[model samples]
Target: MKYNNYYFKLKSYARNYNINPQTKKYYNLDFAYLVELSKLDMYIRKIILELSLDVEHYLKVRLLNDLSDNSKEDGYNIVGLFLQYHRNAGADIQSKADKYSFCSDLAEKHLDEYKEPKKLAVWNIVELLSFGNFMELYELYYQTYPSFNYSDYLKSIKFIRNAAAHNNCILSTLRKPNSLKKFSKTKKLANILGKIPEFRELENRDAMMRNPVIHDFVTLLFVYNDVMKVSATKNVRNKKMEEIRHLFCDEDGRIRKNKIYFEKNPYIKESYSFICSIIKYIDKKNKNPKHTNFLQ
Candidate 1:
């Protein structure tokens, strides 16, 4: 109830234009659709923090690791900091479990059918990861929503989410979120020209997210944390991007790292670029809000 109230209050704040998280640059808005977007951002931040805690718990106890309770203090510092700063938290111990109950239930049913966890690979479980009654969600899901130019942006993020869910490195407190490419993937990525390169993309190898119907806290934490709320100028595309020189990255032939063989990973770089563009768009929104708070 507290978190729910808090979430709603934050939603109100955004709607009033009382708080614009952005710096002075540009993507600001006097009249903006803040409620849904703010809620979404808050939801994601909460998820990542929660998932980090889950990861620590799994590594210290569930995985049969040698570390003892005293020896390992949530090995990863990510949650430790989050827990320290944010007053908001899930109400109960099982709150995380409850949030993911749908996925777990589907996992159980599927696992029961197989009668063995070994048979259920991470890739095999995407159907189970559906949001609500996962089956219906899966039926309508599309890998590439081509209708939206930013479909590719969504695709890149989906890959990161899948990676966080499946990879052990992501789950362990011992591991860090430094390398975006390290996140697991369903299969080897196909090479697309300049848009995406193979070697640097998740190391250009196929991988699975993770198996087991039940997930540790870390999976949820990573998912929530990584899903950032973007407050960008609404409705800007590649064609419009050229007109605004300031918003674009000043690559200026300074050895475009993007050009280098990202043989190791492109997840972070790709995702970062997308996020920056969104931020720029937000500036545009701020500059030209449909309603002028101050008389024109």
Candidate 2:
């Protein structure tokens, strides 16, 4: 891309990367720095996408199984119940119409014959629903059924998942604090992180969570750990978690690749250290027999 086009995209970031804060003078930004930053973002996004898919798949499987067990049926009835709940809640008509259209398309593509949404099996319905739609279903499922109340965490996971899925630049705003008007810290995650030696201090925890990207990524780790405890596919969870741990915490990991590029930015360096600490903590917890129930 041309320099002007690149600057256009980097306008919001120029203050942090291209200008001297104290001197208040613009300087020529190193193109190599931008390349490294993009590569780092891509690496982070790949990790997030991998773990998010694990969370999404296991969540759907758990929800489907639990709904089937509780309903004591093929679980088709719950679909109607879910739709009815949304309908009674006065969900946007357009949103419902869009969902209907999506389901209709899925039915056409996957089913040999047309089946009404109500007639679709729970697994089929869940398998067909997009991640966003599955979240809506999962939200209602969490409310109506007995489950851990991590529905709130799903919003952050969804945000990061969409960013990764769309190839959005995640590290561009690492230096910026969380600018969200209304952000709530997940107490469960905070408590877990507090137990980790690195985040023992309140200030350290606050500093890390104050950045939105780090906050969301930490939330993903929290959810992934919690879900794996009760996950039916323990082997799969173990394998995936190990892969993630290797990627971020291992000596030959992606984080260690192109390591020099991160040295100039304190925010990026600290953020990487913070995340690696959490991953190492989880790895330790997994290896200790006493904490067998932690992420197993």
Candidate 3:
């Protein structure tokens, strides 16, 4: 979190170019194999970043709207409610006080009634909460609107986001609940896959559950549909599908559009396509509410 001025400058440069500085700076021809691996790694990071931004923005906005409703209905002290929840949840309030000070900082700087909880924007308020606190806050919101249980989606996204943001490997095996029912073929998953012929190659639903890229994308689509405007979600899904398809050939089924033998990574494209297919299915399913499976 404490970046030197030089590191900050480089990070800004990397952001402007949409590339990770670690990918560029750590690579040299002497380590040719590593250089090649880094290229594939950078591309996966890029996709994760893009997807996370959309999910985070949509969730924050939706939660803000719900908070606005709660405020209007009961004059709820939303900020106070969050503080109390964290306190009761055994969060070290005094120790992490500084991290949550955006409320106090804003109150003093802008609000006329400085003693009142600051009318912080949802995105700003979320930044102040630890991930655990955020989940608690989200669960409170979910209680009122019980249509989709977004707790699982948020948990899954947090795992993916932390790994992606920290430049950690996301290809690790997923740990699912042991109590969750095992299915030879999940009805929800089978129905989803039935629509996306391109990804029928992913024969095993179990494998998809274990695959981070596929798992993360499916979670994103579920939450995206829940929060975003239906029409907007459709358009977003289409755009994502188009981008995924661009990574490979339609006819020859060759991975990586560039076709440079040295730079191509087939696994990357396979994962991308597999996820894109699910998004496509979700988009189609959205048109009919009964068919929409909020696969928890």
- lDDT pick, better of 1 and 3: 3
Candidate 2 residue 4 C-alpha distance from true site, Å: 16
Candidate 3 residue pairs in backbone clash: none
Question: TM-scores, in order shown?
Answer: 0.21, 0.78, 0.57
lDDT of 3 by residue, 1-296 (tens): 24422333223222112223767652212233333334545566666677777767666666776656654534234555665566643233323443556444533432334233344444455755656566787777676456455665676677667767887544322222221343232345446554555555566544665555456656655665555544658567556645544543343333343334323333433455565566555556665657544453
Model 1 residue 248 distance off true place after TM-score fit, in angstroms: 23
Candidate 1 worst ten-residue window by lDDT: 143-152
Candidate 2: which stretches are off by over 4 Å? 1-18, 21-23, 26-29, 71-74, 87-105, 109-116, 177-179, 195-198, 229-236, 292-296
lDDT of 3: 0.51
Off by over 4 Å in 3: 1-37, 69-79, 88-124, 130-132, 171-202, 232-237, 248-273, 279-296
Residue pairs with colliding backbones in model 2 are none
The TM-score-based order of candidates, best leading, equals 2, 3, 1
Model 2 per-residue lDDT at 6: 63
Tell me how far the alpha carbon of residue 211 in candidate 3 is from the true structure, in angstroms, after superposition: 3.7
**Lowest summed lDDT window (length 10), candidate 3:** 9-18
Q: How does candidate 2 score on lDDT?
A: 0.68
